[model samples]
Target: MAVRARAARTGVYQYAGREIDPDNTHGLRDTAVVNVLRDESAVFDERAVRSFIGKPITDDHPSQPVTADNWRTHARGTIMGAMRDGEYLAFDLMLTDAPTVAKVNAGKRELSNGYACDVEIGDFTAPDGTKCQARQKPGSIIGNHVALVDRGRAGSDCAICDALPSNLFDTLKTEKPVKTMVIDGLTVDMANADTAIATVQTLIAARDAATGKVTTLEAQTVADAATLVAKDAEIAKLTKALADAKPTLQQLRDAGKAFAVIEAKAKANGVAVTDAMDEAAIMKAVVDKAMPGNTYEGEHVRIAFDALTKDTKVDQPKVQPIGAPAQITDAHTDYLNDRAKQRAALSSAWKTPFNAADAA
Candidate 1:
């Protein structure tokens, strides 16, 4: 599994410069210091000693061991004077007993492309339960550890040192912000910042347009669904109306038979029936002619006609009465004689012998 680096704390001031530590409690007193302006022989000068009782030695002087009496007079005076004068010169802290030259080389090795050495500035609680200002500069391992540079005394503040910017803007001003951008497998060198920004804007505009088109399609789909629902409702209404207006099978059969009877009656009265005449028209014509000189209403006449014809017998082929005897033919007489002979044989008490003559 890969571990992601956590974001650094906020409100922690950062400086892209060196810092100075005056504390000698961590066995860092013998750490070598150098004077940049002097020759190699003056690198370990007495004034470069780590500190004289928590104070930095700024001026080169003869070597003198730190004593209780001189600690306050010499070491404390020099550092306090510098602070009062507002001298915010860059300084280095003897944080470890490592060789000074090696540490410097290590700091240089940690510098990478597009990055610079920086220090994180913040307040820290000292062993004496007092708040002290501290500076943490990048070590040789970059993010692994940091070298602490503490200002002498608690509550000592340095606004100028803590206000340095730690971003890459200063370094990038002399170089291009971006080197290359890969688009569709094609590498494009971002030589101009304006052109790169314009490309991003174009991509954003196209995405917005496509999103708008998708939204429109969704809206159209909803509208089409509503239209289908309305059409279904209309079809249902039409279906019901058709069911109410059209006659059923049984109703059609009854009306057709009644019309047939009315046509026959019209024909019997010497009236000609035509295909153009419907049941109502024929009934009206017949009722008017049959009831001539009578003040009978058409509705009453139709009712009487229907009642009279309701059980009227239909003409059928004549059939013989069930009690009438059937006429006998020669074949029937022979059949009767054969039946009589069988009855006589059955009635006899003795069994007859089988003979061809008897069969004849």
Candidate 2:
């Protein structure tokens, strides 16, 4: 493994370009002393930098050293987001367990890193030009976990921060009163005032457009409901009318059937009915065809039509055809001869004179 280069250090951390304030009682000799122990700085050499970069963050240092086999059971979260704040490695701790988060929020602010290294007791100079008695072997440093504690080995300098130091933002020079707005639960703090205003306006316009579409949908729903009510009322009225007229329909059907039968019988017997005739006219024609010369009126026409029903053969009445006649019978020839002799004797008596017949 190659030795890695470390970041430069200044032996103390500041609230960086911000004004210093005095603490009431947080256990510190000075107000801004983030001391990284000037003489014994070998703990943060190049070996420590590589080993501690991606270590896990825990509530407290476990009794046993954390390893890959047991890290899952011991790890609350990782502190891989380590930034070198001078000689002290400033890392962010996010406890995965709810109880640990509550404890940290309730004033557990200090952090201590648990690591193993081969310390060679000798007169040696650290990479930052700080002379020290114990020097850690370049390849013998191994990081386990950075733990939250009541007080760290490095004092309050290695601690959890409630908020970022104000000096991190060099853009606070603007005189815009430092505006802050929230969009969908996200706080929007920008460097430029004009950019912030434009963002707020665009978000508000999108919200208003969504509200308008919701209103349109609600109005369309009401209109569809009203149309359904009117259609239901029309259907109900039609259904009732149909029910009320049901009683008379059977009688009308029976009359229609009888009329059809009479018309059919007349047509079969050589009568042609046309649409020009009404019901009564057609019935009268039917009666005339059946009886040839008889006529009926009033209710008697109906009675005559009923009598013809018992005999459908009235439609086929016998009649002589116009063709050569057949020979006459013997009885019919004798009767014709007797009628001629009587007519001859009556003529002779009249010729003998009425005076001579009286004297005899």
lDDT scores in order: 0.40, 0.58
Looking at model 1, report the run of 10 residues with the lowest lDDT sum. 1-10
> 143-246 in candidate 2: lDDT tens per residue?
77888789765567667756633542364456656567566775677655677767766776888799667655644554454346556766787898887677
> On residues 166-223, what C-alpha lDDT tens digit does candidate 1 reach at each position?
6432334435456778754545566766865576566657777997786566545544
Give candidate 1's total backbone clashes.
Answer: 1
Clashes of each: 1, 0
Using lDDT, give the best candidate's number.
2
Model 1 misses residue 357 by how many Å?
81
Model 1 residue 43 distance off true place after TM-score fit, in angstroms: 82
Among the numbered candidates, top TM-score falls to: 2
Name model 1 segments beyond 4 Å from true. 1-178, 183-191, 246-360
